[model samples]
Target: MTTLLNVTLTPDQRDLLEVIAAPWLARGEWPLWANVQHHFDMRGEDADAIFHSLPRVGTQTPFGAGYGFTLPMRAPVDGKDRVRLTVAASLVVPKVRPVGEQFVQALQHMIHLYTSRPMHFDQVPTIILRSEELEEALPDLPVWFFDVLPDLLSNEPTIITGGVHTSRRAWEREVTRSVLQYRRVQSVEGYIEKTCEIVVAAAAQYGPAIAVAATVAAEPERSPYIDAGLLAELETAAATNRWKVHKLIALCQGLNDAYIAENPYACAAMIRSILDHIPPVFGHTDFKHVAAQHVFSMKRNDKTHAQRLAAFKDIADDVMHRPIGHTTPRISMDDLPEPIRLNAILNEVVIVMPKSAPPTT
Candidate 1:
């Protein structure tokens, strides 16, 4: 998997990915099992159950089928069936911090698992995971962090609203003191000796190119790699770690201490891997023709009736717009806090930037 993504996902992405993968796994279609069976020469059903366990499969919409995920083989894909396919879609946001990191793990895992199981999700079927629950599902964090804290990806592109709007970041000196400081530090003091060694050695022993990369990542002017080309180059550099370079690249782009302290090797490695596999996914659109029926209702106003069309907006605002930082009992931001934040913050700083073209002829 690291060979493919090079660590494009941060922590929150891993969380979302776990939830995203739950649906298919619950249905006994986990490609991960197939992958395991292929390597270990295990029984089909036995391998299936282990890989499809509750902790793994139940991560999907557990209560019932058809929670929030969009599937291609079901309604939207096939028009011949009356009963919808027994596939459920769901993702539980963690109540703890480290938001985006979860999604990154899940994303990388799911994609890698997909290569093993081609029939379940279809060869890149029309699938869209709903991120709305995440908006209201965050833990009960204060509004202060909310203001400066970067918002995760919304319906829009990789644009984060309601923050100082930085292109790149470095571990702020303060994060070492804050709760986020414990990032990947195996030692209690919150130190990432291996991470610093790699970066310093890469800069000092390797060549001037890495030195320039190290310096540029911490630059005040959003680093010189604000352009797309340089970001790709950075990802290539980080991919050398293969385990966590994406996390490192994110850390470099964002200097949050918690993020840095944790998984310095993995982060740096992921960057290099993703760089090697730049422009990873190309989304193709799919159209569904099922559920031919249309929904119609009467419109009313003045808060007197339940069918008030005008009240739809108000009701939605009250219900749908839950505050961020809330917890998810089973899964959430804190499961791997630092990695998640690193993924989110660094994604903003590194992955989505528009690169400047090299000097043209």
Candidate 2:
């Protein structure tokens, strides 16, 4: 399974990237080649030589428009999905590697090089693995990390594989520290090195679990728990709403998790939440107006989209908008209707954004 992630940065981090990327950006280099020879300090490069030396799908450099570049490591695009890295204003990495463990290893490598502080998060600053794609890939995400942290950091004075370890405490500390540093301008000591240590440690400790999660995520039994079709729809929605990656990620995570857990009430709650969230992103307040205006570009009728959303809203209202004193009974799995229609509605919102085109001064 290929995963695309957009790393949201703090203003200071953005400034740092601007400074590092200034010379190239000034030269009209949108999708600059990743300087393979010197990965960390990318000043000038011999593009041809770097491309030849680096690990990739082929000799051909990835064709794209961006200010950053792909990492120089060899990519695994066979059997496993390929892991492609594009570093720019946003450190966008699409895991295309064939093997899930390989992808996690690549993720660890790029993540280490990217930052010590947990810059990649949802809305929060902690090193929260905030991608629905990731959740699908790693169902027991937090547990998996804790399980794998010890062996990865085995060289340290205190460490254990498949057992409780201090690395868990260390990992938590790094997240908290990163959150503070991200929110504030203050710098912490050994932030980058410590981050690398923590990440690598976790990766090593949970190597087996990571591989299993990746495999399960990549190839799940035919069940509503893992919907490949819905995954595709969500991915399309994600790419369209790239600018609002954080919000999209949060929403996607909520929707996917609810479905996987088979909780109709939670799914309904997500549907309503998505309905409320869509308006502001598209520069509209009334969802009915949005539907009447034919906001989605997927060639569906406004009336149809409007009605489906209305139905979704009604279904969600039981859990989402019940009165404070009203005792609403919990919805049972057997009583729950799968939210395929709501998923389509949310995806349609992504499709129609560019077409709607909010007014400019």
* Backbone clashes under 3 angstroms, per model: 69, 17
Which one wins on TM-score? Answer: 2
What tens digits encode model 1's per-residue C-alpha lDDT throughout 94-193? 2222323333332333233334433555354322222222223343533222332222222111111222332332111111112222234333111222
Off by over 4 Å in 1: 1-22, 30-339, 354-361
Model 1 lDDT on a 0 to 1 scale? 0.26
Candidate 1 local lDDT, residue 126: 29
Could you say which candidate leads in lDDT? 2
Structural similarity to truth (TM-score) of each candidate: 0.16, 0.32
Cα error, residue 297 of model 1, in Å, equals 35
Residue 69's lDDT in candidate 2: 26
Residues 250-343 of candidate 2 have per-residue lDDT tens digits of 7767776876677777766766676776774456786665666644543432345456676656667777667667664767654443333454
Clashes of 1: 69
